[model samples]
Target: MTGWWCASRVPKWARAPIPRWRNWWPRGGSQGVRSSQDYVRKAGAAARMMLVNAAAARWKVPATECTVERGVITHGPSRRRLRYGEVAAEAARLQPPQDIPLRDPKDWKIAGKSMHRLDIPDKVMGRPVFGVDVALPGMLHASIAQCPVFGGKLKSVDASVAEKMRGVKKVVREGDFVAVVADSWWRADQALQKLRIEWDAGANGNVSSETIAAMLRDGLADPKLPQARKVGPNIPRPTSTTPPWSRRPARPG
Candidate 1:
């Protein structure tokens, strides 16, 4: 049987056919899909036109004056031109999504090109702010301490000494885990290091990866094993692929 198409092979321009939602705003806003395709078509056209117009206006030139060439933008007499990067901030502020108009098909230059990311330079220079880099005044450090056993319960916790420790403000024990909030990450980590957790070992306490694998092997050996797949109305025998454990057999053949 043939395999499914890879996601990358799918055409981006060819959109999934879905029911268009109706625009109820024309006669006092309500809700529902549009009965006709005309409105949707007009809106799409208008948006494209607005973008081009907005770009031109932002650069302080007429719609016909500036042209988006390649990824860069150019304006003024043919010999003298500037990259879109130079004026993107101003152009973006001017567009404001709702206020700007898209360009007509004939007026487009940059949009037609295969688009690429605009923030590559910022990322390479490590100037972008990610979640991990976020900093706030008076913010405290926090870390999680998970239960040792997969399904175990925490009987109780004694944090009398931990609370008195330097930089440690409080110890929070909730559900099956505990967290120590402190002035700094080093202090929180140190406090957590000193914690003595009392766990009631459940079913998974002694269950290691090897033990689970043995159980799975026994299950696979059963003739009554449920069929995960039936290809072409026939049961395909499992192939013998060399597993790392199988290499060191007790009695080598």
Candidate 2:
């Protein structure tokens, strides 16, 4: 109850009180360390408190008198000691306390220090699985071709040749692109290359450097255009500004 919702996924009958430490990392920008560390710290403290409460109940002492260190709880007055694993079952039954105070940074043993990365061994041994490494039983591969010109549309595609190519499964065409599916990526790529396709290059296809330069010049001359910055009123405008290309180059000595 004290931890995040995902803590519920941890089985109550687990042999040890362990936080879901793996979920702390940011995955696909979903969460950052700054945001996750607080939750993890609080949840871990709550779990430790539960174990301490369970041990205190067995010893017939107040939970506050118990101190936890390295998974072992010790009662100061009675000299009683209990391992977290020994009280894990009873602790699981107890409702987690709310708003457990985090330990002081000065007392931290591992955090804010260099330590061995848990993922290094698996990565070095090439044992870690990735998205590209996964393969399914009947998975197909596809190769796509998009219009070469900007603002162009797909006009026509003669897929008869590509459809008959070896290992080619299907040929699909959309508004601006065509795709060839096959048993393998290479076969799909080969089939896609064989297809005869046409694209309708719209008005933008005729755009050239001269047209772009003219547009920039028009924008600079327009008084209605938004000014990037106006430090003060009554700023003097330059009578003329030399274009970079129009300037003569220095002669060789």
TM-score versus the correct structure, for each prediction? 0.49, 0.59
lDDT of 1 at 132: 58
Which residue pairs in candidate 2 collide?
none
- Tens-place lDDT digits, model 1, residues 1-253: 0011111122222122334347322422443223323333344333333444556665556767655444344565553354444554554454324443445657544334564666788999998887656779998886658788778877677777777889998898977788889988789878887787787667788887778778767666676755633233477546333334544645312
lDDT of each: 0.57, 0.75
RMSD of each: 14.2, 11.2
Q: Of the candidates shown, which would achieve the greatest lDDT relative to the real structure?
A: 2
Q: Can you tell me which runs of candidate 2 are displaced by over 4 Å?
A: 1-31, 34-40, 47-99, 207-217, 229-253
Relative to the true structure, candidate 1 reaches a TM of 0.49
- Cα distance off (Å), candidate 1, residue 77: 11
Instruction: Quote the lDDT for 177 in model 1.
Output: 87
